[model samples]
Target: MDTQVIVLSVVADIVGLVSVILGFVAEKTKIKPSEIIVNDFVYCDYPTSSVLGMAISASLMLILAEVLIAIAGSCCGCCRTNAAGTGKSVVGIVLSVFSWFAFTTSFILFLVGAVNRGVNWQHLKIGDDCPLSSHLPGIFAGAAVLAFVAVSLGTAAAFLLAATPGSSSQYAQGVEMGRPQFQVPSNGTPPFNRPTI
Candidate 1:
């Protein structure tokens, strides 16, 4: 294993252990409940087909990010002397920042909620007094910022790797061999020749 991967594995294991411990503590203390109430649950409503379409879109984005990260890291070359090593470092830093943001944000949200005595997410018709807490907005905003930073770094790393001549040729060749090709008509004819476009 490369030094970076070893380091990351250790860090991830530590974080996971800490998270598990804290989770158990929270569960025992009854500070953070995990139950979800469906009565007041609200999600974006759309046509039935829209659900699958959106899911596929989201899945593609996630997969693209993961694949790009892997490519960048591997291209970085054993974390010893490759430029791809820098990419791995960037990804690691981004994740660390995100984890820190999440931890702090959750702590603040918990404090704000406990002090205010104003819980959110009330069951409207059920008359249950579950007021949607104010902390959720901050938590979501923090998470969004973190996600954007991580994705931006990942994209930049991928672009850098692809733009380099050596890796670019390899990636292009791989894609060419793996992806199906089709020709488009010069005239305005149907393009079923193109996959399910």
Candidate 2:
């Protein structure tokens, strides 16, 4: 594997780990509940648990993919030539691609959820008879940002792995068959003596 590819894999792994941690934090952090009383009825606004759960699941998948890639890259010797090693790397790339999709979806969902929650809070404050204010915790926003970054890094790593040069079996076979790998210069174009036609 190329050094650049290795570097990319490492970066992806680090980002993935960070995203997982942030997702966990977001899941644990809860929005402060506030009540509004109107016409002798009480209403409370709470954070969306389902969205945070999805974020955690997606982040976990990203972490799994990144860890797998890092392990394969470290253990697979001469990935270009060894069929098993090459296959392992290919699997890693596929996992990374899946992780990218998951991360992207998670990020979008989190963002939309946060925005909607904010809008609802604003509407409650301005339009409702009983003014109430509640917003998502900062941890959720941080997790969304981390998930987005993880997607970018994971995608880059996958592309780098896919672009790695594979061993050329045909070139080796040609060399074994005593075939010139490159065209030799003609006598007229070289510094050697040329025979008369």
Q: lDDT: which candidate is best?
A: 2
TM-score for each model: 0.29, 0.39
In TM-score terms, candidate 2 sits at 0.39
Candidate 2: tens digits of C-alpha lDDT, residues 61-111: 555655555443432223444233465456645655555565656665455
RMSD in angstroms, candidate 2? 10.4
Poorly placed runs, candidate 1 (over 4 Å)? 1-60, 72-129, 159-197
How much is the lDDT of residue 12 in candidate 1? Answer: 35
lDDT of each: 0.37, 0.50
Q: Write the per-residue lDDT of candidate 1 for residues 1-197, one digit (tens) a residue.
A: 23443343344334333433333332233212233344424421111122222222322333344444544444332232323335545554454445444434434433442332222333332234333442233332332243344444444444443333333223333335557766778896776746665
State the displacement of the C-alpha of residue 17, model 2, in Å, after optimal TM-score superposition.
Answer: 2.3
Model 1: clashing residue pairs? 76-84, 76-85, 119-131, 120-131, 120-132, 120-133, 121-131, 121-132, 122-130
> How many clashing pairs does model 2 include?
0
At residue 97, candidate 2 shows an lDDT of 59
